[model samples]
Target: MAVTQFNTEAMEQCRTTVSSQAGQFGAIGDGFSNQYGNPEIFGKLGASGAVSSAVSAMDQAGAQEFEAAEKVLRKVESALDAIQTSVHDVEEANKNSMRAV
Candidate 1:
């Protein structure tokens, strides 16, 4: 069987990048709402409600996507750790058996 090696550092970096992107999107949404989404401005356009709704939807979607990706990565990391432990245990058992012979 081919040895399975998990690049934990790379996975962690990917998770951090996704989290940072999510945070950046949230900050952008906040800034957009505060700057260009002024009630007075949107009211003058006669689409204040529609604009606010769109912004909220985008923010929610981004958050959900990031959250899902992070969860998957966490699960993968957990599985990798379990596999490593199991492999080590098997190796130790084999060594003990050989020493007894």
Candidate 2:
């Protein structure tokens, strides 16, 4: 319990320190500030950013696939409606013929 309280106090102090600094969080500066301080590390960070962008693009593609599949399902439903109507008409015609006989 004492350790938890100590850690919580330390975290609040750190938060206060960060909040006092304006513009400390800038473009690509939030998580990679330390990396940007070193040129070699910054290059690796650029590559990591590219990978992150690619993953986001793939996620968009997955959403598009789901939309396309939904369109196909709607078409299938329309076709099934037509088929059902034809079947019902045929059944009605057969019933009328039996009544005539």
Candidate 3:
């Protein structure tokens, strides 16, 4: 005869850890947005009064550079959300199986 044991405590811990990680990811994303969400900073380069035209084009183009970083952060946050949800689902499934047994 084989004995099967379920460690639900560990599963719950994992779920908690995953939820925290997801929250951290979301916080990072929000922080990135808050820090660089404004285009005005990237819009102006050199003296404010003169507004150097020499690098004006480059300055304008640079504003969009941070957009990719924001997108990547959002993607990571979304992935973490999925992982967290999957962890919860697995925990529930295991608990159900234990109950059935």
Q: What are the lDDT figures for the candidates, one per model?
A: 0.61, 0.49, 0.54
lDDT of 3: 0.54
- lDDT for position 41 in model 2: 37
Write the residue-wise lDDT of candidate 1 on 37-82 in tens digits: 3345565677787886677677666656655665665565566556
Give stretches of model 3 more than 4 Å off. 1-53
lDDT of model 1 at position 68: 61
Enumerate residue pairs that collide in model 1: none
lDDT of 3 by residue, 1-101 (tens): 89645455665566566556655555554444323233344467445434444345444445444444555555655665566667778878978888542
**Candidate 2 per-residue lDDT over residues 4-79, each given as its tens digit:** 1124344445545433332332222233322222234336675766665565566556555555555554455456
Q: How big is the positional error of residue 57 in model 1, measured in Å on the Cα after superposition?
A: 0.6
Cα TM-score of candidate 1: 0.60
Residue 61 local lDDT, model 3: 48
Highest lDDT, which number?
1
Model 3: lDDT of residue 65: 48
Instruction: Report the lDDT of model 2 for residue 8.
Output: 39
